[model samples]
Target: MTTTAAAHTDLDGTLPPLAEPWDPAEFETRLRAVGEERYHDRHPFNVRMHSGDLSPSELRRWIGNRFHYQRHIPVKDALITAKLDTPALRRMWLRRIQDHDGPAEGEGGIERWLRLGEAAGLERQAMLRGDTVLPGVRLAVDGYVNFCRLRSPLEAVAASLTELSAPDLMRARIEAFERHYPWIGTEGLAYFRSRVSQGRRDSREALDLVLAWARTRDDQERAVAALRFKCDVLWSLLDAVDAAGHREPA
Candidate 1:
């Protein structure tokens, strides 16, 4: 994606300009529009995956590289949780960490994702070590974690709004994996199935927090930029995976 000067400078490089404070509904519309235009679901790599066109190597590579992002999910959520001022908000955010990390061993989203990697022929130990993740994928995932650690709590929560688009993607991915990649057993798809409900609940909570907290025009603009930044992180991860597929084999 091209980053035009206008795109970065629209809000004067610090905050986005809003003509006026947006009502909750309008703010939501704007946030959804950002996802519509920039979400990773539109990336060619994902499009191909959904269309049953990816090679086995491409699929495995994606599975392995994405594990890097998956493992970091709880880490980023921890950062966001730390930024919360109230015990109630912290408790609510803590569920996100628990959702990914689970309360016990051999469970949770990370474990489920490793099951997916194993289904794709990746070694669980190597994936857990992130040994096969591409450099670009590493950079993108790390940037997101750092963004959450450094940005304001509200902006960090807004970045998580990408969850709004995740349920649909998870549904499509479950169907595509079953239809096109039967070699990947149904058990491996547990991650996607669980995410359908989790994504909706998480996105709703995050969106409510953003809407309630972002009261000023500047706050709304920053929230939008935060979401856009997150979209870029996901898009860039797919871009790296796509580029890797096109490179000549050694």
Candidate 2:
């Protein structure tokens, strides 16, 4: 099944069409299947955290470690935004940062995450400074920013498709936090809970943007690859955090 724009020309000037293309239903399936196979919900750490299987210390490590990724949201969006030459593109991408960082200091996802940290017993200063971030997590997120800056806008947006799979993970995080970490009050987990609602709206809009703009077969392939790249970025971050929990005493 190929969509109207699903043909491609190769280096040798041979033409090929994608095995599957943008039939509306097929497109939706492909886009969503990417999330089903690769989303963080499938990651072991996420599984453990949400299943009430992690210890308090493990939960704390996750919160502290993920603060690094949460902080990088604005930075990555800025990098992606820098590559956009059009106000339209800028307008759409900028909202991602706004959604996370909020309109002012006391608002948005980052500050909410801080409240979460404070509730978890981690120091605000340490989290704000990113002093406790794992080295691997930093490397992975930096790579995502670099990919967005260097790749085409379609690809950059595709990389953001992990957000498509994020709402489910957010729900699981909230459920787990509420059930297992009662010591951490609603104020602390409020950030994570808020994100479930926001991530759904944001990711849906972003996915539509990518799908609508990715008209050609080559474009779709690149878009899919970019999404896979993003999944690795997310998966690696979790892997780093989970691995840290297993490190032995020196």
Candidate 3:
């Protein structure tokens, strides 16, 4: 049968049900597994980035395109916060927004990313407008924001668990930028540096929330699927960047 038919059969109970609920440790293992196999850190663009293969223009293009994603971080976090029913959960989730958007002007991850764009030779105003960002990048980012807005709160929180693997990638990226892209300026690395610690903290909180909430087999499966969907989102963004081709010389 075709894949769609198989899915319909499974939904109709023609196929056996999924296995029982995993222990918390097992569930955590499964969630991390999604990142292991699918995280964008393994994407070709990142591979070339770490290996010092991307040209200055290629690097600038990535910075510009990725800024589109960066700018949306707080927006997605706000959606997740809005889905939360408890004050405690909302309070905890609100920090993500603060981290990305900050309390004042000229602060936060969004601002730091724009600094990186400037360091990469992109005009600050143009990067802010995002007019030159690749179409695929915009679509991928919008899809992720919509996922958080539409999915269950539990699934949305689980999706943000991609932060679990982000610290390692951020650290490696800082090293790569410092060693290979020395001309980009030290200030530009601040975004990656800030994320290393923030990613770990955010992932821990998200994992705890997922572990507490995903109590049933179906819930566990959905949480895992949410994480996988997020991995695909990141991977698709990179795929789009790769397809758009590295920036050509002026």
Candidate 4:
């Protein structure tokens, strides 16, 4: 997939001269437009996987490498949550942390992803150690987390609007796994299944907050850029994964 400038470059606090803030509906349409144009759903790696063209080596490598991104979700959410003002806002946002981390051990999305690792022929311990994670994947995911950490609370939350497009991707992934990679047990798909619903709920909540908080054209533009940056993050992560065996040694 072709990456936009938003993916590789910093925002640098630039925007055109302020105009009227877009109506909520149009602003949302614009956000969805970014996803439609640049979401990782169309990346060749993903396209190959969905079409049953991925080798077991590639699939296993991806399961492990992608776990690096999954594990940091809460850390990113926590940073954003801290930046949110008011107990009510923090309380609402904290559910994201709980959803990923869960209320106890041996649960949550990370735990489910580890089970997915097991299903894909990776050992739990090794996956936890990020044994198959490539340098580029790490850099990409870390850049995402840092974008959340350093940006405004609103922009950080805007980056999460990727969840807006996530449910369908999760469904496609589940279908792809079942159809193209049947050697993997059905149980491993729980993580993807879980995300289908989680994605909808998260995106709705996030969209409401984003629309409400971004009260100016400048704020809206920055928010859109943040979402674009996130799409690039995912695209870049896949770019790294697709390069698995071809990269030069550090």
Candidate 5:
């Protein structure tokens, strides 16, 4: 039996016309376009990073602030996991949390990010203490956390669609680091390397879910919007990181 959007159920009381969901191919195309237009990969800071133009201190400042985002990923995932409707779905979502937090300390993405911090010459303790995290960066990261916490599960999953573009970005990052930022060392590239494969897998799963669950025109629009919102969050993060911090209060 074919599965498609259920009968017209207005998202709000106004009862917008019960438009058919877009064809899967069209829906996916629309989703991809959000990243094409708004993804943080286009942010000036990322453009500079990939071009190998950022000074070491500039790069270190970014890594330090980025730690908050990295560490909070599992927290947001856990919140979504709790809201997932099925055990199997929860199990699948739980893997994302584990991917970052791991079953034990000294493992997982957070640990790798810490290694990245160390390679960038930021003290491990300082990163852990959140000392170098600029106020703007903290606010942007918190915005992401609050987005996941407050949005519907479908929208939350859709937001993670940022992963779709992450693999290619990681590849470019690895090459950029190897070629231009030799001071960070091969060891520091591990996070980006691991993400190349992880991003592919995670994005495929997320895309499948978004395509399946966004069953109405409203759902589809919201999913696309959620993806755009996530992209904006990422862009905002780079904006904060790339700006001069001299005037910003601690």
Candidate 6:
């Protein structure tokens, strides 16, 4: 007897229902599966962008819209940081905000992102302010901040598990953008390049924190759910751009 595709409700029919509670090992497997199946690596725009198939104008749109998420990372970290009671944990978590906001004014990841914006023909000040960002993007970012505020710290850190998979993606994006958008100036791609190192370091630290502290089966389950929520946050942000009537620059 053969089962039809509809018989399986989840992305992989073989897996258990996403709503079901699970042990730590099973939860981790499902969490990683969520990344594998639904992460931005599978986003259509990303596939086109990385394959050098996107036109210059389309590339500009991606950078312009993505600036909102970039600008919100520090804000998200700030929300998480405020909940921490330990000076040591706060000190460790503070680096994520600093990485994006920079050591001083006019520097750091946010500044690097602005350089990409300028190269893409967007106004640096406007992008920095996130003025023209999509409503969905704002909703997703604010949800992330609230998730950190409302959830356990381990779960909050787990939501950032997307970073674990980002280093490689960032490297690929740097190479692809450099190759395809030569007129945009290679130096402007430094934001992607910097993420390769920063993402790996940050993700490793966050992963250690999550896995070490989330000790119960329920804790593990909630942590995985948090990660899935964060993945949706990312996925929906890109979907908003795609759904906004923007297509690969024709």
- C-alpha TM-scores of all predictions: 0.92, 0.88, 0.91, 0.91, 0.91, 0.85
Q: Tens-digit lDDT track for model 4 on 42-61?
A: 99999999999988888988
- Which digits, one per residue and each the tens of the lDDT, describe model 5 over residues 48-142? 89999888888898899888899999999998898899999999999999989977988899999999989988999999999877778788878
Q: Give the least accurate 10-residue stretch of model 3, judged by summed lDDT.
A: 1-10
Better of 1 and 2 by TM-score: 1
Which pairs of residues clash in candidate 5, taking residues 3 or more apart in a chain or in different chains?
Answer: none
Spell out the clash pairs found in candidate 1: none
Report lDDT (Cα) of residue 131, candidate 5. Answer: 88
Q: Which ten residues in a row have the lowest lDDT in candidate 5?
A: 4-13
Give the alpha carbon lDDT tens digit for every residue of 1-250 in model 6.
9997577756765755444456556666776777887788888878887898876656666677788788888987888888778999999999999999999998899899999889878888787676768787778777887888888777788998998789989888888877777778877888888999998899878877876776666777788788889988888888877666463343
lDDT accuracy of residue 201 in candidate 1: 99
Residue 47 lDDT, candidate 6, scale 0-100: 89
Per-residue lDDT tens digits for candidate 1, residues 1-250, read: 8886576655456545446899999999999999999999999999999999998999999999999999999999999999999999999999999999988999899999999989888999999887878999999999999999999999999999999999999999999999999999999999999999999999999999999999998999999999999999999999999999889484
Residue 16, candidate 1: C-alpha displacement in angstroms? 16
Candidate 6 TM-score over all chains jointly: 0.85
- The collision pairs in model 2 are none
In model 2, which runs have C-alpha deviations exceeding 4 angstroms? 1-21
Prediction 3 TM-score vs. true: 0.91
True lDDT of residue 175, candidate 5: 94
Lowest-sum lDDT 10-residue window in model 4:
9-18
Q: Is candidate 2 or 5 superior in lDDT?
A: 5
Whole-model Cα lDDT per candidate? 0.94, 0.82, 0.90, 0.92, 0.89, 0.80
Residue pairs whose backbone atoms clash in candidate 6: none
Model 3, span 179-230: residue lDDT tens = 9999999998899999999999999999999999999999999999999999
RMSD to the hidden true structure, all candidates: 5.3, 4.9, 3.5, 6.8, 5.9, 7.6
